[model samples]
Target: METTSPHYRHTKIIATLGPATQTRERLTALTLAGVDLFRLNMAHGSVQWVAEIVALIREISAEVEREVAVMIDVKGPEIRTGDLPEPVVLTPGDQIHLFTTNATAPAPTDVLSVSVNYPDLPSDVAVGSTILVDSGLMRLKVLNKDATSVRCQVMTAGTLGSRRHINLPGVEVNLPSLTEKDEADLIAGIDAGIDFVALSFVRKADDIFALRKFLDDRGSPARIIAKIEEQSGVRNMDEIIRAADAIMVARGDLGIEIDYHCLPLVQTQLVQACQDQGKPVIIATHLLESMIQSPIPTRAEISDVSNAVREQADAVMLSGETTTGAYPLESVEVLKNIIQSIEPSVSSDLNSRIKLIEPKEKMLRSTARLAQDLGDSGIVVFTRSGFLAYVLGALRPRGVPIFAFTDNESIFRQLLLPWGVEPFLIDFSADPEETIQDAFERLKEKGWCVPGSWLVVITNALANDKVIDTTQIRQVE
Candidate 1:
């Protein structure tokens, strides 16, 4: 398989592997089509199946003489109602009573008995609070609250099935972010040498730290990615961004939390913030929604993908389009086309738009600019959360490519979408000097640089530390 493409030089595409495209041949075709990384959604399949796919991807990459990253997406905390006999449809203005007590529907009413795992569900919910089911397929407004049940009125009419997802906005649905299932999956991913682990529904920085500590305790350190979907995530955005290895703009659940009309603004703000902080941002969900069935994409979908590329998103992803869609191969091809077509139009003058601060910020930007001005072969950024790398990329410094070396595997894989950023995963080291030397030698071995060539290394002096204390411009020898 030929992995090189003129159009893919600046941007990377991530294709998900699922039941629709799990064959070795299909995977090979996707790789040939210029997929820089493969996302293994652990939320959908068994561990054995995912392990097979990961092995196949690595085998194919080795055979093709190309490097491809694999990212494992963990199933985060998700709340849902238990089984229903059939799809239940509700109409606007209909009174739907959601109860903890057993009840059946019949009397000109849309009341349904919903099973909630949380014992204090009724107490946590307040009147007038919104309840979104199955990503807003059905909407319910709280009418009255009690100790065990909450009466509600249907706000939207739609069919809902068994185990349909439930979303409570502005209400703290107390649940562990990482479930036992996710912990098992994380262990499997780490054992498989997976490049990334994406944490879903992250609400605070503590969640990230806790996961990191867990990995550390297990002696398996995978990069932790915080998927921003809830209003709490957006409110704690700055701290969350600072804590995780990378950030994912998960628009599906986000739409359920905030108004759909506000998604575009949220997307832009999140992307800009990630860039400003130098952390890789992934624009996920419904990038090619129409392509799930059609062989090609709608004009709006094309524009959406183009906008992500123009925004300099590290990578653009297709969830169902490449996983369980009818046109998996066609979806990958169409995404490749859109990415290739829109990449050249990306402005290389993004550095001027970056807002520079003082002390560390000024020093980091100065080093990045110097590298670009001196025509250094590449700029090496050692980041825990990928913030430094994103900042350098946002600067849009020309001539010098940005190589992000991190211990976090999720950050390594999530970086596949950013313009000019090549993420590499390495063993966590305690010495910055050894880390810098290793990076320089690795780049030289890859012919990315030569002896006597200029290279800029920017990293926090302390290993596993967030504070940036050093920036060095060195002549490779």
Candidate 2:
């Protein structure tokens, strides 16, 4: 499949960088194969490693002449089991002890025991609470607990490994939203000039607010992407979406927190909520896990990516599939192929899923309708903040491309997160008319618009030093 040109597909691809795809050659291949953004996971990398990856991404981005975004995924307050001597096999009827510790304790031979990094796990969890480990591959039911220890009975049997993630569904663990490690990483990421920072294990709007405050205090403009991976986050998704600049459907921990069968419904709801609010939503984790080992993806994985596109998710992410996969380039190609195949149908059937949340949305909707009615014209959006472009993309105007021109580079990268919105960075012009004319000329030169073609142009008209939403129909000369 021809995967080099992804301009036909508006849904972006976010690929993780790790051992397999860390080299310049492999990263370049991923960029050419339609990876719009690269994610660096702080969970497994050091500050120096992240800096190197950021540098590599910029180098490749310059080489490709595409402003590929870089997102630093901070490991937030996550509960993880302490080290284990070896993988312990648990049976359905076995009892285990979980305690809190800072350092790796001696191997426990007396009982099947483990420790968590969170010291309040025993105090937070109660009897009858469920404990999931290793992304819910192993499960345990809490039978007893104290300040020092939590006794659990094995409900699901599996081999438990060391330093695996621990989840307590329905139990609120008293841990700070930002760990000390995360703060250090955040500083490093800001210094590296990352475009976005994804806060892992986000459970409330306050989490986003706190991170926003941190960024604001430092005068850093990196956008925050709230990762919804907990039950509390799902329940309070409305406020979280309002607070976050973007969202990531972190289905790995989310599947562990909620019923596995309900994931599909939850994903759809999250995607819809984001679209309604004009926030970019990314569906992540296990999109193509089979590609990690094999050269080709399974049929089911292909459908999973397609469904996310149909749901109008701004992007579908590849975690381990591209990070540690042997066929990282092939994974990117396969994902692009799937999106390119499904996006046409999605665009043809696109409808107004966005609720008129604000008064500006109503006008945006009307403008989109006008573009659709004209049928032969595309939409040109001139913005300094990219807000108008985001609103139009959320409206999902079928059969019309939104060419957004912005003076801000950050906004241009952020614009790529929306569906059907292609952002171009141009010099800022004080006169709105001049900006529109320049944009029209550039669009014509790029073959997106032609002479004598009609276009619906949207911008904030300047008059009396006040800006207002203005949509004008013009014929390109």
Candidate 3:
């Protein structure tokens, strides 16, 4: 479609832009090496930084003539420790006080204590609750509490630095999904025309609905990606998945909230659920942890990526590996290489794994199976909203290339994230048959339609259905 070639591998790559890959040269290299989306983590950057980076990415997209999607990941209602002069080191049985007040620092005490940003932290956490800091790098158990402070015993000791995250397992912290800071970020991101917004620490569908309402109010078309990293999020996975445009299995904080052994199962379930719904799912966090320093990834890291591919995850993401890593370019290259190597085996059989849950899915699956059965045939799908394109892409039929035609630019960009669907930005015509004929002419011009090469033409206009209406198999003249 559009003369530009599709990636050899169907699975997309999302790279985080940070200190390492923030420059134009590094980002250009990553874009050329097949990074489909760039995630700007709001937890770290200021508004000025985000605006500048978004401008640079848009400039790069214009130069490359590719629609590079930008995602601004907002920091939701999450708690973090305040600034400390030095890292606090504690051993077993050491008492640490977590104060919930403006006075972040205690008066130079030998005993360890730090102030948290949330004033209601002590009220929410019980004496027996467990507190994890910096994704379980340091562990503490609540031993006592008062009106403004919660004193804890250091169960697992590590260096506790300034502005570290705080996690209370089995404790429900009543906070609004969107904080004031998140609203500011979202407004700025929408003004900058970000393609996606990832909401962090999402606990239920309501969180996603609130963000959606905000976006709709501003008439912004930026899609919402729910970051699932909490136990409540895991429990409400179905509602969250249905509510959000996409999902990211954020394992960094998830490992701290849930048992370590359960992370894999949760990841698998999330990926499978997203696949079943035809929504994109990203496997993120510590995928190539070692590559942050070393030039190469560990064997387990390779297998981890490979496993996501085998599971038919729509995409895999690089967090720290492409952010502050010394080997950012190497990490992207290695991830690309691994996907290229393992794609052929898994992509061809991806349709079999998808359960046909809905009528649209059933029709789409049958269309894909037909195209695969008829060797040397190509598929041309005309979608107005891009829903049908995503459905077919999720099915992942063998050997058949899908040529998707849509007029909407947002749909064109969203189509890039899905697998097997090569999207083209074309004008919409009132006559469905005329549009089909025009699309075929373009395909024939590109030699995609050759002698004895049958083609399957699919569209949603023939039936009364709103999502997807029709699939017709035809032989090329």
Candidate with top lDDT is 2
Query: What TM-score would you give candidate 1 relative to the actual structure?
Result: 0.80
Q: Candidate 1 on 1-477: residue-level lDDT in tens? A: 111123325556778888777888888888877788788887796778767778888898778756677888888888777777887777887766555433333222435656645555677788888888888788888898666667788898887678878888866567887899888888877777777778889999988998888788877646777899999999889899889877899999998899889999999999888876667788999998888888888999989988988887777888999888999878877877876677666654555545677566667667766775675456788877776776666666644578889887566655665567777777656777788888888777767777887777776665575654777778888
Q: What are the per-residue Cα lDDT tens digits for candidate 2 across 1-477? A: 111123566788899989988998888888877788899999988888877888888888889877788899998887888888898889898988888884345534767778878888877887897888888888889898767778889998898888988888977667788989999998888888888999998888988999999999987888889999989999999999999989999999898899999999999999989976778899999999998899998889989998998887888899998778888888888888887778767645444566676777687788888887887677888777888888888777756788899988888887777777888889867787888889988887767777888889887786798898888999999
lDDT of 3 by residue, 15-111 (tens): 9999999999988888888788899999897788878899998899778766678999998887899899988777889888788875444433756
Q: Residue 179 deviation, candidate 3, in Å?
A: 1.6
Ranking by TM-score: 2, 3, 1
Please estimate how well model 2 matches the true structure, expressed as its whole-model Cα lDDT: 0.84
lDDT of 2 at 149: 79
lDDT of each: 0.76, 0.84, 0.82
Best-to-worst ranking by lDDT = 2, 3, 1
Ten consecutive residues with minimal summed lDDT in candidate 3? 1-10
Residue 115 deviation, candidate 3, in Å? Answer: 1.2
- Full-model lDDT, candidate 3: 0.82
TM-score of each: 0.80, 0.92, 0.90
